[model samples]
Target: MRILRTWECKIDKEIEKCKQQLNILSGVSTNRTTVLKIINDVKKHKDKALAKYSKLYDKAFLSPKDFRVKDNEIEEAYRKISLPFVKSIQRAITNIWTYQEHIRISKVSPLKTGGIVLDTLYSPLESVGVYVPGGAASYPSTVLMNAIPARAAGVNKIIMTTPPSKDGAIPPERLVAAKEAGIREIYKVGGAQAVAALAFGTETIPKVDKIVGPGNVFVTLAKKEIFGYAGIDMLAGPSEVLIIADDHANPSFVASDLLSQAEHAPGISMLVTFSELLVEQVTSELNRQITKLKRYADTKRCLKKFGVIILAKNIDECVEISNKLAPEHLQIMTQNPRALLCNIKHAGAIFLGSYTPVALGDYIAGPSHVLPTSGTARFSSGLSVNDFLKRSSVITYSRSALKTAYNDLAEISGAEGLDAHTRSVQIRLNSRSGF
Candidate 1:
């Protein structure tokens, strides 16, 4: 990994390049074009397009009838996985449920004005689809994080879609997690095609009101394209972490946290510190740790390409740089981590102290791991129960209220050249109950 001073001109150029890379539709790359074509095909052919892409991309051949995973298969998945694994998933579910329940919005609240009663109602979406990335690896945690919140919000139908292995089977762990999270409907399909199937219904997969989860560039692009057809969580990109540490922070722990994110292959890992000695120690530790990892080649490449250690003037400078980056995961291992949090304006999730690593948050720390990535933390938030609920305003005005406010309403409507709006209010005010 390269070390540079924060004031260097090269840092500005590299940051700009990172911003451009995050833009899925900024340039017409081959990947973007392919995703567009897949979305169009799925929109036109529906189930036929899903089968074609599943075979072509996933090498899993299946017809529309074979799309949804059978109930017997879910039961078999439980039988295949070990008891210890199941117990851990159940524990994590409890943690996630507790967190989601605390954050859930109240069903209804009313605000009474002088004569009008303004009420707000929060209703769960009829159905929601969660995309769990599978194939080479499995993420039961993703299922728990995405499904538990929707269930807490009282969503009627919770659907899950994941890519099948070359043998055309979803991972046993993923299936078990879905079942524990209260998801009954799961489809063995993935990629941009799966996203399209959920947005625009097919023969087997049902159309959902909203879709949430993280995926590859193709899936992200697909979500962007079908956004209007259905509500979507934030458009996520590759995983990333930014650490602000002091000299007191342990070099070994910092290196381990950085490598945890780097092992994600395309993930970005960065450290900004005021102590030059700590930087050297962490850099040496990273080299030693990388040799031991199974994904050494890819992790090393990621560190070289996207990783950096910056020498900041002080802790305030470190905070400034972090706000500018708005990383998906922020770790503060300084002597006073809490004091630094006040200056942190943007970050999807914050991990404090050396003991609290990003892995804890990713697996069992209660918060959903599907965070806003690629500087999107500045505007968006991580997935939660609120994402599955829709808010609508309820206005009730009495006849006397209309009579008192009609002149002012008509004047404003007339100023905007909306005669029909003015007439509608005037007609109400001129009715028998107007007095």
Candidate 2:
């Protein structure tokens, strides 16, 4: 694997060396005030800090009556796995519930004017909590990408959790992908005291308004310190890709899409190109396909420290250093990747050609492999059904529409000091004269 100064690189020092190489994806190497004092002693001794951090980090011995996971152990984990991994988790939960059942969003106009009326309402978010990471293994594809978009946004109580090995069980293909995403509330609990028992609630879990997946970094700093007491799905980092190749791409399909996101362990796998002979034929096909990789030491330290093979002096300077390294899987492989995808602004998922890798958008290309890493796809997205719905705004007014905006609503509620919102609109226009 060659580096040769990424072929005289200098596009603002390769975008300040990919933002100082994402300071090793700033996460998971513990000690944040000793994991926030064991997640504030599992949020003030809940189930005795989840059976003493499940016997000091999954060496097992959990109790509180073995913390949920029954129903004949989800029919004995669907009769002990493999029926082609249970029909590949029933074809990836029917392609992520038919691609998040087309991210619904309705409730529109109830509009009128003089006798005013307006609208908005969509609801659906009773309970959410989904975690699914079993350390160094078992994801069951993050339980079909966070319970198939909270069961296509009609949520109503999905609850799940992981981490229980060392001998305490819980990973039979993560309860057969949470019982094929219908999620029969399984729990065992993982780090940061399973995100403080799904953000504080303990008699045996059940306090969740929102909490999706992907963890480590003490469960993403205990979901960034219990985000406003709940609701969280982003702040996730570590896991990236950039690709952008040319010179007719493939050196064994760009070394298997840079070791399939560098075995997603301390991951970040760049390869921006303008071809120094296809970066020495994709660095000798990533040293002969990384000796038939099996997470070859975490894909060789993620291709030797946040990999790179950059050359770029064309292909629009490798799409301007992949829009300043906005990679969370941005593959492109040119020669008209849909005419450079109208100058891709930033990417959380792009995968245009070379048989569209990025592992087919990480399992049968529906759209979400829970994206937006470090550069936060230059804003944020991925994980939809608009993140399990919630919207409300509707109004109605009459009395000749408050006497046609009574003095511009008392001059904008007396210019913001809000004098009881301008004497309740001048006591309903001076006791109803509608003036």
Candidate 3:
């Protein structure tokens, strides 16, 4: 990693690059043409399109009959995973469930005023589809992070979709995680086709009220296009971490955190601190520790493109820059992380102290790892039970209350040139029989 002074012109250039990475839709790979074609093909052909694309992309040949994973397959998945995996999944589920149950929205009594009743009704989505990416690796954590929250929110129907291997097999760990997370419905489909299947529904897969989870460029584009037709969680951009450390912070821990985030090909990692000595120490540690990672090439590439160390005047300057970045993950590896916690205005998730790594949050920290990426943290938040729930403002008024609101309502309706709106209220007020 290279060190750049905060006062240098190069730091401004680097910030612009970070902005570009945060904008998920602007990349060349996000071409809407291919995504639209896939969506339209699936919309028109349904199951046939799904099978065709499954063979083409995932190399898993299947028919409409084989699209949905059966009960036997999930049981088989449990057998394939290790005992330790089961224990780990159980712990993760318990933690996530406990946290979600606590934070979930609940019913509240209506606000009663003079002849008026106002209610805020919270209801879970009827159904939700979770899209888990399939590749060389299986993201069991992804399954837990997405589905557990929905389940906790009281969503009755939770289905999952993931790509299959050439052998027409989904990852056993992923399947086990899905089952554990309260998702019984698993689909053997992936990519834009899978998203389309979920959004529009098919002969096999049921249409969901909303879709939640992350994916590759294609999956992301599919979610972006399918937003209004069905609800979407968020258009998550590249994963990123901004680490603010002090001279007292452990250089090795800071470097490892940055490298772990860099494992994502398009991921970003930054170090903003006041100590030039700490910057040098971390850079040295990054060079030493990165060689040990399995995904060395990708991590190296990520660091080369999106990694930087900024020499700040103090922790306050670091916080100010961090607010502007609105990073997906903000790790404060300072001497006193909580001392500066109140000033952190942006960031999807903040990991405080030297011991709390983003990886812990990614796996078992009880918060959904499905967080808003890029600068979206400024306006949005990480996934939780709340995302799976919708609120409706319910209002009721007695005849006396209507009379009280009549003048203002009629005046506003008339000003807007909506005669029917005013008449609708007048028709009720004018009725002598009701009074």
Highest-scoring model, lDDT:
3
Model 2 C-alpha lDDT per residue in residues 97-156, reported as the tens digit of each score: 887786567667687767888888888789888887787777788778878877787887
Query: Considering every candidate listed, which one attains the maximal TM-score?
Result: 3
Which stretches of model 1 miss by more than 4 angstroms?
7-10, 21-28, 433-435
- Model 2 reaches what TM-score against the true structure? 0.34
Model 3, C-alpha of 54: deviation from truth (Å): 0.9
Global lDDT scores for all candidate models:
0.89, 0.79, 0.91
Q: In model 1, what is the error at residue 215, expressed in angstroms?
A: 1.0
Write the candidate numbers in order of decreasing TM-score. Answer: 3, 1, 2
RMSD of 1: 1.7
Give the lDDT ranking, best first.
Answer: 3, 1, 2
Please state the error at residue 301 of candidate 3 in Å: 2.5
Model 1, global lDDT: 0.89
- Which of 1 and 2 is the better model by lDDT? 1
Per-model TM-score on C-alpha atoms: 0.96, 0.34, 0.97
Task: Give me the runs in candidate 2 sitting further than 4 Å from their true place.
Answer: 1-62, 65-112, 119-127, 135-160, 168-203, 207-211, 214-242, 247-257, 260-280, 283-285, 288-294, 297-328, 332-369, 372-381, 384-389, 397-435
Q: How many residue pairs clash in model 1?
A: 0
How many clashes show up per model?
0, 0, 0
